[model samples]
Target: MKDKIRIGCGAGFSGDRLDPAVVLVKDGKLDYLVLECLAERTIALAQKRKLQNPAWGYDPLLERRIESLLELLLEQKVKLITNMGAANPLSAADKVIEIAKRKNLSVRVAAVVGDDVLAKLDVAALSLETKQPLSSHGKIVSANAYLGADGILEALKTNADIIITGRVADPSLFIAPMLHELGWAENDFDRMGKGTVLGHLLECAGQVTGGYYADPGKKHVPDMVNLGHPFVDVFADGSGLLGKVNGTGGVINLDTAKEQLLYEVVNPHAYYTPDVIADFTSVKLMQQAKDRVRVTGGSGTTKPDTLKVSVGYQAGYLGEGEITYAGGNAVGRAKLAGEIVRERLRHTFNEIKVDLMGLNAVHGNALHSTEPYEVRLRVAAKTPDAALAARVGEEVEALYTNGPGGGGGVRKYVHEMIGIVSCLMDRNLIKPEVIIKSI
Candidate 1:
């Protein structure tokens, strides 16, 4: 078994920068490269795309990413693992094979599947969020279980060059490599927890590398424009050192590591995942060097018997319109425009949100004290009927000519909104399998 393995993160989200991933593959000398690109609603949106076209459900940037890094990854012998498969892992693997063939590179790709649990889902069950029956959510678009690292571990055993998966837990992508390379037992809860800590820290790619920690003068991050992603040197005992590529424009000190550790963590004592219930209360973050942090002291209990399943359904449609106003009481004009749209749609739609962008958009009316020289009037509403939803933007666009005198830069948008809810399913109900394709 290897004493330690080096892993690097590429893209954090679906639309993350492509250049940083290229830099990591070319210079990081990573044994494994993980791209944790799937979000709760991303796969749901990809399902909609798949319904429109069979071959287009995966990540929109998958092709470009594969084309850019495939050659370098092959040259460096770096295996890739990503949830970029989104709604379609099989087709994603096929796409990777096609890219390899086009570039005259021989590579084996593994696609982890069977996360879709819609057919096995008990719709009568209550949602974990609303405590309401799943039937109340209308038409179900997708139901995917949060798979763990077992499927990925199986894929690694096959020596695949790339492993693509659908709806796996974000941290599991990073943990699987540790478990495989370090030869850590699947039931080793302490090691699993430590690996999870490393996975969670690096899962967001640049978040632990100062991308999300930047707050200008307060928490100033250097080279914000050229922020680098992170890498971890995970030891067999589960401790790791987090750092970034040298000469990259980001810091990986204790502050960034600490901030990322608590991110999205509802309870630090019992952070649940597919692999184990990691306890982050005892995680240690010590600055090892200028841009490196030594992370240790994470533990966990047995894996949960139930897995979280994200259910996506047809929520309805969202109609939105924005109009900008400048000079001479722009906030007042924006407020008046928002009020006009609200008044028109209040009776028709149950959920109408009107806001003055510069004045009361984010913090609501509580922070409405300051009036800026320019303000934007945004009116949005959710409705079941597409025609009614279209009327919301139409009314806002009409303000350019009739309601508000100085309204300019009018923008209108109407799209179907996917609603996401969560439910727990038995672990045995999910059957993850890996399919390998090669060029």
Candidate 2:
């Protein structure tokens, strides 16, 4: 919107650290760059880490990756927005500020909050389908309400170099600037829809460009290790550029882009958003050939009344240990051995929970309904202490005491102890209230 603004977006797992998407945006003289870090499991993992160590829960993988990207941004002087904060954006932003201060970069960091309504979570207000609060449930491991794009717009107004957010809607990241630069008001539904669609397409950088998808017709998209992220070059009227890193290892073919569009979205025409229900059917993807696609004609409709929420909690702990089998009744023996172990444990203790994962319908009824010649026993337990979780692991091998065919010949399997919690959120509470904050 600002003359010619270029934006880049990327998707990467936290286990490894490298973001080429942001790198390309900086090098290409883009105005904005965004990255997504939180996944379905990210919240639980963040909480688990917090439970272990309060100041140590959030993943620093993205922060480290930002270090490299920030260096380039500093060199080229480009601003970026990212929701890399796994659980707490304020804390995460503070840490990044410290890093910047040490290097004397003079980068301003602001965190967008008010979306997380965990303290006042009530299941009575939730819609179940929306996952917000309409009622009350006493136990909630994690509740993160999605903030809309306006807050990021407010942050950008302050002209900060970097915006670190806790949990904002994926589409909002790309839509914020369009609202800010163009002076677009709340009634600009059509432009808003276009921004939303653009955001969704670029949310998972490599996926749309054939990182995970491999078309038999295209041989260039297969080995995408150094995959680049996604970004859009936006105009004041609500259209932009869709491309990747110049030399990254991904493709942006039309087929792959369409596949990513269908990834997890329910209704393409009625794609709901807090700001507006963007209609992607109007979106025209012009295949620019290898690793490039031109997206246009995306339109929008009225904004929805509710917001989206992400809820997480402990689902109970499970431990699994498997022993090999090479006999005629290997499957039968494994089942019997599992039953014997369960009986012995229940007799010894009352509240230990056990389930046969590999041997039963745990995997899928279609995989092995009648049982196989050889199978694995996956056992688990939930109790007051780690000892109980470990006890199941210790006692399962004793099944061999029943005799070689009856229970013996039971080679010891690897032992595992698991601790799990149950997590659910009210559908009503999932909708977040968008509030813009500035430095």
| Per-prediction tally of clashes | 0, 34
Q: How close is candidate 2 to the true structure, as a TM-score?
A: 0.77
Each model's TM-score, in the order given? Answer: 0.98, 0.77
lDDT of 2: 0.65
- Candidate 2 per-residue lDDT, tens place, 194-248, comes to 8887788877766775677764675457447776667677766777667776776
* Tens-place lDDT digits, model 1, residues 1-439: 9999999999889999998998898889799999988999999999999999998899999999999999999999999999999999999999999998899999999999989898999999999999999879879999999999999999999999999999999999988989899989999999999999999999999999999788877887888788889999999999999988888898888888988999999999998999999999999989989888999999999899999999999998998998999999888788888888888888898778888888888998875776889988888888888888888889998997778788999888999999999999999989899999988
Q: What is the lDDT of residue 149 in candidate 1?
A: 95
Model 1 scores worst on lDDT over the 10 consecutive residues at: 363-372
Q: What is the lDDT of residue 39 in candidate 2?
A: 67
Candidate 2 backbone clash number: 34
